[model samples]
Target: MSPSFCVCRVRVSTGHCTRCARCASSASRCTRLPDPELERGVRAAHVLRRLGSDFVVFAEPHLKASNMKNLLQKDEKKEEPEQTVPCDHKTASRCLLNLMPVVSETVSGTLLNGTFLPDICLEVVHDRELSKLPFAKSNLTVVLFADISGDAIFCIWKADDKSTLADTIQTVVDCSLNIQKNYGEWPTCIGVTLRVKIGIATGMLEYHFFNDDFDNVHYSASGTVVEYVRNAEMLCTAGDIILTTEAWNFLEQKGVHTRYTYTALPEDMVKVLCFDPSVTEEEKVSFTSAFAGVRPALYALNFEDAPLLKRFISPVVVNIKTQEELIFLSEMRHVTIVFICMPEFIDIDLATLSQLYRIISAALKETDGVLNKVITFDKGCSFLAVFGLPGYKGKNETCNALMCCNKLVHEISAMNM
Candidate 1:
């Protein structure tokens, strides 16, 4: 990577910062925001973010690094003077996925060359792993599906956890393929060589409500130029551990060595990195053991949807672990939960309920805020929304809640149904 001259990273106005390639300014001056006392009431400018060589906004609209004052005032006339209690029952869970055989029967009805992993089951397993990861880590989940029965077990490190941990799951897989010559008939009973194909990838984990039911959600990973792990598993023979470029890069960053470039794709298509087990048993033993007590798991990906209800909200009331912990967290941060409900949902037929769901979804969108966790009960339809999330800090939580609730109500009322 050669250096270029564009280095003007200072803001001259709201939501806009300028970067000049031929800049000769001091480093400290370039990164600081314009003092609000000196530069106020400026026009809103386009947000600029650099991606690779060029700066652009790709998908989700991210606000510029600045505080936003609540413009929605309580003095405004309200059709409904009272507010309903927000849905604060449930929370998110952060855990590393065991990635065990959660769906053997569903994916392996017919064995194909000792490999029968279906895509749906693959995603379901990914979702299960994602539910355990905590917030604060990059919410990126990478799945490396082992060719042996489509099982996966990776490790993760919380952003706050500093202790070193081993990915025992990877070691177990490495050990299973080594017991062939241990004088045990386990391999003979299995009737086949236990080879594991490991593929690693980094991608976006996206979700949408399943059949308009927030309780049931579908999650999928989309990696950019790093989805080779899925394809690499098909070409590699069993007992082979193949790592994608993405995974190898991560390992390189972590200073974990147990890998060598085994070979290249037919025409240099993609580089194949592997922890060659064919090396002497001593080396293989050192290889797997070399990774123990490493900070952050090599295969761990954190699935962070902060506030738990950032996308699909679950119904299980999250029992706060301890009252003191809850009180401490509340004191440190503040968020207003909003629950949207349709009072007549219970009496309606399925057909009518479907129509009502569409109406409510549209109303939520008009609020310009995310619908965190949504709950549909027998009595009515409800959504749980938090005003101020962990990383995202707005000026006023109450104003945000009021504005969101008002916008949703106004949209629903205008629907004429």
Candidate 2:
């Protein structure tokens, strides 16, 4: 017969092999056997240890291999399923981690932006006050707006004489503090250390706010304005008021002149030497009137037959323009009424106008006979509706009118997309 290969069984607790073709009398002698038999013996021992005292050991090699494979498959079946994390949550986590170090730096920059408004106000106030002094108008207006050791500082000086500038700046600073104390509006917070830097700019009142052509025009300080202020501030020491070359030139022309102590600027800084000073007050009044007329017209459309409109319409005149738009509404009594002298026609496409009308009609239908036909003149003109007399608002006429108008505008705008 060919050499028969037989598996041996070993008891892990007793460290003894049961009778088989590979068994040895002594446990230590088991290692002396042939390599093939020794491997089979070791594998058997492992299996016996895992199965405990009552496990059956087989002499067949094929059965042992199949059993080990089944054991591993069973172990894998007991594990929980893996979960997926959302992309947005993961992205937010990454962003917060990256921004952690820079958060303080960003906050410091934002604080600087808020300080710009207050600083400008201080400089203007100081300049006006100093100009009143004898012979001070001819020298440069060096204004410093800063905080020193938690005290708000406003300093004004003239650069022509260092001793005079120091004396004037000290005097002005004292007066500014007294003004704040009297008004209960100190510039600095208590218990916090603060420092101020000043910028000196001199010129005629070349820049001013104006209302022309129904639009308000003020100094158009784009991104460049903030940058210039920041550069000037950076060059200044705690009490020093620094000025750019452009500002010095304008100050010289305005009768307040300064000798440059430090004169250098980055190549990118553009000099804003002059600006126009003009405004039209008439256009502002007209614009206000136009807005007032349109506000009520829009409000009336929102609340039809509302008690408020009765009180509201008496004081309001819909026709704000020289030429009025007209609206025709069909009444329940079979009489057609016209709303004359409406506001100017609104410019809208036919499709949008049709949709707006549909929304208004649907909203009115909800209130029964309180509202009926609505007629609007021109594409975007105010609407005319007969409320309560023939339809929806008859019983609740006081409130229904306003309610209908409000709902109509809201629903119409919602469907615009």
Candidate 3:
């Protein structure tokens, strides 16, 4: 009744797919043949069996699986005309617009040729991973393009925004994990594994344009940075998130700690080291325990829109408020805990207090030499600020904490002025 196609019984990792049969696959995951003979044989066998014929049927050859279905349903965003990649023969172009929605603009107030160049670019190379196409439409990733005409997929991001960068990375990682998690849920997954090669690079990059005029734009990324990202992607193993040195350095400087070493990539490449984001579970548990799945359920009635929830896990940095929470962090010693209590005599209103507290918390996050996590608390008339918790041992941790403290003081003073 449905479209009949043989789901190739082949294992897949990255772009490499094991052949169910040489003739069955050239570059595709699996090819189905018009088995009129098999179909006729089966029908005839059914008739024979009804007539009590002993003729047996080998079910193996006929029971092939189907490919993943299209999941990129234009979510209920009808108010905004269902935007799509242009497919034109006249004045229009074939470029995939809106992938990196926030393409950089020049000082001249004109959009550059294709789109504004963003700070970070991530390429996802996948085979039998067609399901992830839906996530590409999730707004976090600018779905550049994906086609059987091309070898893999291209997704870009505006990496300079620290929160955007973190969210983008988290989304991409979630995509990879979901692909694997939901693998066996579909019939086709038994025949293939969704393998992904992720290459993340950061720099002043303008993901160029591909239009009807530039017929040659589809060959591959021509720019040096783009080429380097592609090369890094190729070097990635299955499900690896490899970052170029520049990108890795930028994140590391921001206090994202991961145990990595330098590996001189090929001359044709761009990064000094290939840093992998897939750290051990033990390594992640320490900091992640602080907020893993700890967020409260958000609803449309309570929040503005879904995009608002995109704020990265850096919620107002404050420790949990219970005795258990305090005990949990009690053993965390030598930590620079600075308590900024407003002078007891000066009564601060709740509204003003909230604003000042957030400003101070943000200062800690933005301060250089400060580590990633800065736990803060709103203990009534005064606020408690703590730094140098586990996972952050920067030699200048205390000094940086003091810097944040001074920044907080200056900002609060300016606020009053």
| Per-model TM against the reference | 0.27, 0.18, 0.26
Residue 364, candidate 2: C-alpha displacement in angstroms: 33
Q: Is candidate 1 or candidate 3 better by TM-score?
A: 1
lDDT tens string, model 1, 298-332? 11212331222222222111222222221111111
Q: Identify the runs in model 1 with alpha carbons over 4 angstroms from their true place.
A: 1-138, 149-194, 203-218, 249-261, 267-417
Worst 10 residues of 3 by lDDT: 113-122
Model 3: per-residue lDDT, tens digit, 32-53?
A: 2112221222222222222221
Q: What is the lDDT of candidate 1?
A: 0.29
Candidate 2 displacement at residue 112 in angstroms: 27
Clashes of 3: 7
Model 3's lDDT to the true fold?
Answer: 0.29
User: Which ten residues in a row are the worst by lDDT in model 1?
Assistant: 43-52
Error of 2 at 205 (Å): 14
Model 2: worst 10 consecutive residues (lDDT sum): 59-68
CA lDDT of every candidate: 0.29, 0.27, 0.29
